[model samples]
Target: MESTAKQDPTAFKRIEFLVVTKNAELLSVSKDLVEHYKFRAEYSDSVDTVDADTRLSSSPMMILISLEEIEGLQERMKNLQQLRAAFPRSHIVAMVAGDESTDDCEMLRGSGARYLVLLQEIKNSSKLYYLAALLVQGTYIPVPVSDLFPSTQVNFNAYHKLVLNQKFLPVIFSGFTFSDKKYRQLETAQQVYVRREELGEYRKYIETYHDQVGAALKKRCRVMMMSLMALYSEILLLLSLDCEAGKKDLVQSKVSEFVQGSQDLGRYLKDCPDVWNVIAKALDFQFCRYERGPYILAYAVYISLKADWGQMQDVVMTALLADLGILDLTPESFKTLQKKNEKHLKPEELERYRHHPMNSLNRVMLRELEVSNETKSSIVCTHERNDLKGFPNQSPADKIPAEAQLIHFCELLDRRVRASLEDGILTHDFVRKQVWEEEKDSLKRFNAAFLDKIEKVLVA
Candidate 1:
């Protein structure tokens, strides 16, 4: 490792990171990370020593604190708070034991820390490096605490079929106000669809409540949703494996688990029907972050449609496998396709892109699973347009199944909504407005009546 003292002081005036830890293993790992990433860093066993250093008068970008396995947990947290108070601008990351309790973890977050991770999770040096990189880029990684939530629960009888009329909508969200102090009425809210103006405010109010639930609860729900996505990813991985025959039983078991989990999540959301809007936004945030983003987005949208358990399972299965063909494409090929416009694609590339839907259908048929005919059609027709302008056969609206339209609409909507959020715009309804008014011409590609019904289900 390069000696910090021998480095050019004038050139490396600002330290990029500061690692404070007493644990021998953590200290060793931190040294390796600093050497590997070439970070201008300072190391100390105590916060006081770091604070007293004259060169560190200007705070480092991030502070990594390791919590030792000691009896005086409160004392350690107090020291952490002292560090936070000293460098108010720096990002504080607390690394705690894997078996740490939820309450203790919450305490760490509450002590002005920006992030928390289990020490066990970073035992792998590669994982630690990845985590550090993400933190430096300001990506928020929610702690895994799904155990705090209740297990799979179903209570359709408790589902509230909220009729979102002007008179009833206010009563449901009795005390929600915007930052500017205007109350949210959701006047156009109905069992089917909300007006464009109402959708943005409606999503904002729900997101605010979700945030108000505190970090621990927020993380718990995020973990629960990510677990569902992990199962979907696992299934995709199994299908791509060489030993397909041997993996069939495992795939079947995962499929069963996913169906039950989806149903359980659906019931849990429906049971608190008044808050369905909130859960929808939350799921959107979670699903948009996962690798199989559209798959989970389709799941979230289908669940909102209020389908029966049997229909829900089929829709979920369809969503899960709808884009399986895309996996056959190399990573670079997919990246190029995503980054380039359709007009920029070469003839052969365009042909391959157009055939992915059929490729997916053929792959699924070969599996010989218990997938229904409706699911099979949905998987293949996901990209087909209502006006017969879509690919893989140009199936018209009449020929395209409802499940296919639902998933397709979700894939489009997710891109718009996620983009809006990513651009730092708070108005989610911006996407809805684009669909209903700005891009009404594009809506011709989808079933008009079905789109109306799905939009209503979204607001309801």
Candidate 2:
């Protein structure tokens, strides 16, 4: 014959418990039970008028109720039935102090109470906590008297059914607002999705907020200017990279794209004068120096003519793209070149160095960037000297295009200022004086019309 010995009723483990009772002694008993069970627990002291709204939202693993405190068993049963409806699988343990009538026990048992612990068995704190823990763990402990209370052996089928029906919609939508209530309602797994959704929503919210603030808004314009300044700082860092390894080309290409994209974005804002004003503010913030000041003014002209003169736009775009080539040159190579004696270079090496601007121009042409024949002519003449001393065709003043002459002057000014700053020359006024002393005569050779624009932007 097979052995028919029953398993120990209290040998199960529980994780979390919620105790609900009006009696302070019962609350104490429940707390003691939770501790003995080796489980984490929380409790509500006012069971008769307990805030079910808050408790239900809390969604604890198990609820413990004292049966002796119920004045009307039927109403309490209806309320418990509703709670079971909301949280189907949650364990409900009812504590009974004395021997009850069969009807009373049956009433409590029918009302979704999974366990009816007798007062005598729970005299010690350890046993009560252990029982509560077991209830929370969802372990099926046999009722002390199964024949008298068959319904005490609750199943998790109702809870699983409710969960399947609800899906996970509540957790998904709760992330938009930052609230403690929202946080508490979600489990750890659910919170992960909430956080991801919140990030995406936050990005969109900020973008919309910026649009609503308008381009003329001083605060909004300041932020845009600050962001562009940061981008320029990143550009400076990228410009310092090694070009021989080909990494410089990659950085230059990215910068070129950024410039092109920003120009295109500016075109879209032309109809919105307020937005255009903001972009102008950003430009003013970025090009505060004499060298950058010319390029800034030129860029403003290019943007202004984007809609009116297609050919001019193409020319300006090409000139903008050409700046990337200079950016692609290694800082170390530039420094070494600056230190070398220009007079010592043999004819062949000097010839090669003279064609560096043309080499850059060819690369841009090969990329098929939007540029006109006039623009290409301008780009080729960027290095030509007015005194007929510059190379790659040693063109005289009349042969050089006005746009190219202006760009050449701007480029030289930028290089000189940058070189002086790197050498720890602190004062801009001193740097300007030194640069003017060296290049004042050469700069005078620039086309009168082109020079006037440069002077207005830089000198005025």
Candidate 3:
């Protein structure tokens, strides 16, 4: 390690820190802190992987270490001692287990730890931020950061779903108010995504009420939805592993869970437009270009529109199973084919691709999942356009059901958004106006009322 006496005055003002731990959750949040708040950060997975001299070479102003048992008590203490000896001037915030006692906390503190937080605090962003701020300012005490939040949550007054948030559509999509096509735009967008206000737009809707009852309900809804997504991913992975031998009961059971649970969640989100809209947006954005993306997006769109629970379930069922017929195609190859213009494909290949809707419907029927006639119609008509431009069958605008129209609109919107994210750059003003134009233009080919409903429930 370099001599500390030669350090310049300006060097003292520039704070950098090293975090040592293998905890994914901790590492993730720490990274968020570093990027969003502009902190200097370095990471080491475990004490053994790094030497004290190497750790101190950079002369970080602080060190953040976790309490997960590493080689036992004495060895862990020895590691801490080495870090303290190497950088005597730096602070160490040791994340201890939740079950740690006052004595244990004091012992770690006595062993050169400057601050302490319970392991559970890692999940609470607010607490993490509070602690980080305190430590940076050289004001944090060696005590646990627990029960810091007020019993009542802050009011959900971030923005109006049907009005205010529409202004931030492009910002929400890419986190910046600049065109993603430019270098600066992409860089800024990534940083801007973590701003509290940006997150507030989504959180305000997800949590419409700040009261205890509303909070409890919100937690339940979020957890259930996450579980449903996990189930979908698991099912997709299993099917891919062995299409014939995939666990049918598991898939059916998980599907049943999502369907049954959605009834209550659907009703809960009916009046909370922002909550469900963001939920749908996130589901579509994160999972797009994958097998389950469309399904989750359809489910989100259905609930956001305040459709009946039974009807929404049918939409989800169709969405999840709609692409099943094309499962045999390699994803890479399928994506490549999709990238090509329709006119470039051979007639037989185009015909084969177009028949996937019917194939999906047939596959679900073979599974004997008790799908409704309405669900069957949705599945078969997923590719049908209101302007008679769709493949397999070209149904007129009036003939397409509102349900099918909603699914189609969502599907197209996700594809377009993903494309923009990849190929173009946009700011809030640019994207909002663009979305409005596109939605208005869509009226020529889609049902006016259906398009209006979509814009109101989603974009607005």
Candidate 4:
């Protein structure tokens, strides 16, 4: 159980604690409890000896009276009865030693201690503090098993179902229930469902909640992303493990899971066009760059908006599929092509590369996807340059579509970032500076406002 201290910022603000125990050991336990939970606590040697008139006057949140003290001064029980009568809002808990008998337990329950905890049962005082906090908040915390038998299995499901769902005003008012293993289990289950690869299953789960689908989806997204991040961590661990004969199979399985999971999430985004826009925007700001394909698409969107360049969806999608033509190329050949000098390329070889944008665009268009004509046109012209320096038709600034211009900038940015990551370059700022120095004149032909916006966003 997590100490409610750090998690609940407001837990100690309103609750005043009273610890009434004569035993030096139990009194020390009470002091530790107060220190751990960061709560204000007052201790009295005996409940009967306590200044009831002064203690009751403060209207403390709760009073903790030891059962031994109560038994020693039975007449003080009358005083407690009167205090309860005078301050109906105050709560009292009876603390008992482990050696107390069953009859004593029943008597304390009958004596008006709303809750009872045994000293021996508490391994540490934080548990007592948590219990007291729950009581003060008016939550029905089940008697700890330790109070009965040390190391008993806690029925978390029943606890959440019964205690958390209770209609008590304080339970509702507190805004959070006690943190326990059961609470963690529910959180884990919700996260798994939220981040599951099957969109159909995820949507079905959301539908089950009916009226709260929107809120549920929002909550699920956080859980799902956190799960995905955790999965990525596992993948990293798998990659780092010492290789054995069977390790290759295990590592490949992990890779397959990661790829499939990402594809499933992408397909889900495809189903909701509006949601895709939001996802696209967020992906733009994410720092991870190991996945160049998705990052490139995100960068395209960012540039298109920054440039006020409409009709970019197809261009972005085309960029996504642009490398397909070279997929069949061997790893060595791919590296060679990436390193090839554009200035020395033969006319035919340059022409092949020039037509790649159109080739990719047509491939996607033929798939019967619901894309606009402007988007397709943007894809066809992405290679066109601003100073009439680019391929195919050597198109000038006026001839190139605004969307294509945005795509070109993003493509360059993607290339630079990837190269930097691969080569151990330290800063995005340095990369941007290099790009500006090399392409400054060409960039001038583009819309000034567009470049300004992009610069502001990148710097931010």
Model 4: per-residue lDDT, tens digit, 301-375? 544544445544454444444543332222233333545434445665555656656655654444333446766
- Candidate 2 Cα outliers beyond 4 Å, as residue runs: 1-315, 323-349, 420-445
Instruction: Point out the worst 10-residue segment of candidate 3 by lDDT.
Output: 139-148
Stretches off by above 4 angstroms in model 3 are 1-225, 236-248, 264-277, 280-304, 307-310, 330-332, 337-348, 421-424, 427-445
Candidate 4: regions farther than 4 A off: 1-291, 312-318, 321-351, 365-370, 441-450
Checking candidate 4 for backbone clashes, the offending pairs are none
Tens digits of per-residue lDDT for model 3, 1-460 = 1122234444322335577888888787777656544565567777566544445344455678886756556666777887788767567777766555556655776788766655554553134443454344322111111101222233212211113111111222323222324334334232211222123233343344333244445443543454444445444333332222324787677677656655555555554434533343333222223433433543454444453322566666665666655544422234334454345656765677788777667666665556778888777777787568885678776666555665665565555555555565743334434654676786544666665655544455
Best prediction by TM-score: 1
Off by over 4 Å in 1: 1-141, 144-221, 271-290, 294-304, 307-310, 337-344, 436-442
**lDDT (Cα atoms) of all candidates against the true structure:** 0.55, 0.45, 0.51, 0.46
Which stretch of 10 consecutive residues in model 4 shows the poorest summed lDDT?
A: 165-174
- 1 against 4, candidate with superior TM-score: 1
- Indicate which candidate wins on lDDT: 1
True-vs-predicted CA distance for residue 317, candidate 3, Å: 1.8
lDDT of 2 by residue, 67-152 (tens): 66766778567656755665565667677755566676668768787556654434421234433433343222111110111112
Prediction 4 TM-score vs. true: 0.37
